[model samples]
Target: MTQTAPSYVLGSSEQEIARLDGQAASIEAATRLLLRAAGIGPGMRVLDLGTGLGHVAGLVAELVGPGGQVVGLDTSARLLDVARERARDRPQVTFVEGDVRSWRDAEPFDVVVGRLILFHLHDAGAALRHQRTALRPGGLMLVLDFDLGSSRADPPVPLVTQALGWVDAAFRSAGANPTIGTRLAPLLAGAGLVDVQTFGVQGYLAPDDPRGPALLGGVVRAVAPQIMALGLATAEQIGIETLAERIDAATRATGSVVLPPALAGAWGRRAL
Candidate 1:
């Protein structure tokens, strides 16, 4: 078997881990829309691949009602531990530690879902095959990820562009596809999934969005080491201490609408 290495851009750290919950919250609305598109509802068994901190899994649990069950899987035990802690009150939810390429389930699932997972994968195609096998007959598989290359700023914020460029470069250096979003449908089709469909959602940041300004700064800071190592940017260019301020100034001065990375979703069903 050919193995693909896992490249997690945000490494395990107390501060970085803490940020994930908020990041999840910021995107919760879009995720719910994708879930609806995937036909997630009561009495369905769900497998949440790359379920960081269990936010999406918990949402799926609620949508599936008490009769359904959700299994949240991840590669990091530390993150899974946090997921377990958050999901302790929900008996229908369980957290497991494993790699997506190799993890198996004793019983097949009705729906397999993931967010921001494929781009970081060594071989998204192989993972998609694994997901297909994990699904029961006629089961659904849905993934939400980004085409960072499609990201751009309106009226252009130099700082935002610079920051995002560094982020994209870092992902490439880590061996992940920065533009995996656009490729989701083809990848699903190649994996032999039928009725494949793809949808795209553009992100527009509001000044008050809790995670907007801070997220850019946090991501840059989190990947600071990699930025330096990759020579994508210098410490002064990243400007961790003042990125938020600069973004704020740009938005206020130009009434600029910050266009975050566009998200694309692809879904298909396994053969019965």
Candidate 2:
């Protein structure tokens, strides 16, 4: 089978790994809610796709407890190394370097999940169709992604809007879908998963919310190279050093509610 190479717009730098850690932290509560609803529990094995920094994998380990197993799959060995070190205390979690599209094993998992990954794929449904085979009977398949278009200030913050547009365009130029969150349910259904269901969560960030601004700024920094390469913006315009501070300032001055992208989640069970 012909394979498509990884085309993540965010380069796999150590800085990017750290950025992912912040992103995961910002979305931790939403993720936990989704995983619980997906029925991840004791003794269940899970496959965490594109498991950067192993954040989601570690969460699965917690949900499944000591009897459960979590294998974090990624193509970047460097990111996996960081995932390993961070998840060192969780004996149930392990990291491996491989593409979920083709990697398989004799032992199937009770669930296969991914966060912020479907948007990076050229054909998410097609990929999931094959990857789902690694699931045991009645296993769950869950995916969570961002609806970038839904992000906005309650009273309209221009700086936040412009910055978000820049990040969205960068993903578009790289042939990735930054706004695929709403399509998640249909994508899973197309992948042949049965009993599909959908749920979503979005953040309402206060001016003092450190995690929200930090994630936004970190994403901008991580994708700045793409933004520049695609001629979306110049370095001076981005002003990586103070972007987060400026966003905080804008939100505080207006007392506007900052809404980061909504995380859309979908899951379905394989036929028994």
Candidate 3:
């Protein structure tokens, strides 16, 4: 039997974009690292998995210029639609709607990239294994995800911890590893990638960073209701509105909040 396409709630999309926009600098840094790690240049072919909003793919397209190609694959039509809309005039870029786990291409890619996608999978290790044959010899595989294990700082508010616990549970239910970033290097190595490496990047939603408040504020607004709807906490126990208010107040007071430390990258090259 044919499988149906996965659907994402509208709120999820907005939250994702907000997260990206809020963390734009970090994302950009990660992307540059991936490009440098992969040694991408004009005339190379790159495949980007989970191309949410397509900003990363668009950047790759520019890097590759007219001689190279960038294809972004995503399961969310809504996200892909947004990506395509943004990439309309760029002939070097294309977006495809499909499952990254099962999608096939006629030719192997020089680079395969998935930013913040592996943690969302039920069997991320298996998913990484599947990409082995999709890459050419010496090809690069790059991933960017949150390293939950890196979260060492204490939550400033007790309620914040409760809300975070709920969000973690919700992500776990969806088969995502909220802390997958820490295991990325090992995962890549196990997948037979050579020269595996990992790195960290941070974003603060505290008073000092201007971008932090707007970004963290957006995240709070986007995720508050979902956290409440998950049934993990009572409205009174961890009030969604209250969390928003606190995040807002914190942002205004500090400028941005410091997110728990996160791993920004894992990368390696396919063995020849």
Candidate 4:
């Protein structure tokens, strides 16, 4: 058997990470789901993997309160710097810069949580195994990620559908699993995690919903330039400048536009 390399780190620098964090709402629903799945509470030791800019870590910190400890680990030193800066006043939270693959600490955690991180790993199973080892007996592990095939809406547009396809292809080509949500339960089961559960959240991206449009548009805008630069698809195909226009037209002409519904979460516990 061949050992897989660690996942590719997306944000290596503070500037690069800030750009990703600026569009954090893209995964806000998923974040909430992970938080719920973890069942975090006061006095629980929490290990946050791939803690980008510490947004999720901050939330976990609040959940754990003063009595608990929240340690956020990521591969980017620059990102850790930003996390440290944000957590200055929060003595309960600590930031560490290291690869999750080789991470080991003095204390095992009650909950090990990751948001939108496993999909990027070349060997997600291995990473999950590592996370399991970091957990104390009977602790829970929660993960939230995208399930490309779960995309559904009231109405649909051809262009948006096409764009989604292109985006999925790009993700797979980049060594990321775009359909991690669907497989999360099985993956956890294989990792010897018992009592696994998964769920999803559905919504549409339309002009009527300011947050929906803003969140979706931010993601589109962030990656559109790169997609165009690669010539994977023309601006016309992705409707780079006219996504809102197209969505609005589709909703009016039909009932809704095909905006991929976000996957909610999946979690299981280490058997005691």
lDDT of each: 0.84, 0.86, 0.70, 0.73
User: Over the stretch 214-249, how does candidate 2's per-residue lDDT look in tens digits?
Assistant: 777888998898888878789999999999898888
Q: Candidate 1, clashing residue pairs?
A: none
Task: Quote each prediction's TM-score.
Answer: 0.95, 0.95, 0.82, 0.84
Which 10 residues in a row give candidate 4 its minimum summed lDDT?
A: 207-216
Measured with C-alpha atoms, the lDDT of residue 140 in candidate 4 is: 90
TM-score of 4: 0.84
Best of the two (2, 3) by lDDT: 2
Model 3 sits at a Cα RMSD from the real structure of: 3.7
| Candidate number of the best lDDT | 2
lDDT by residue (tens digit), candidate 4, 172-232: 7667887887888888888889999888765555535444444344445555655776678
Error of 2 at 97 (Å): 1.1
TM-score of 1: 0.95
Clashes of each: 0, 0, 11, 0
In model 3, the Cα lDDT at residue 3 comes to 28
lDDT of 1 by residue, 60-137 (tens): 998999999999999989889888998899999998888888899999999999998888888899999978999999
Candidate 3 regions exceeding 4 Å error are 1-20, 23-26, 149-155, 208-226, 236-238, 248-257, 260-263
Model 2 TM-score, 2 decimals: 0.95
List where candidate 1 sits over 4 angstroms from the true fold: 207-210
Cα error, residue 91 of model 3, in Å, equals: 1.2
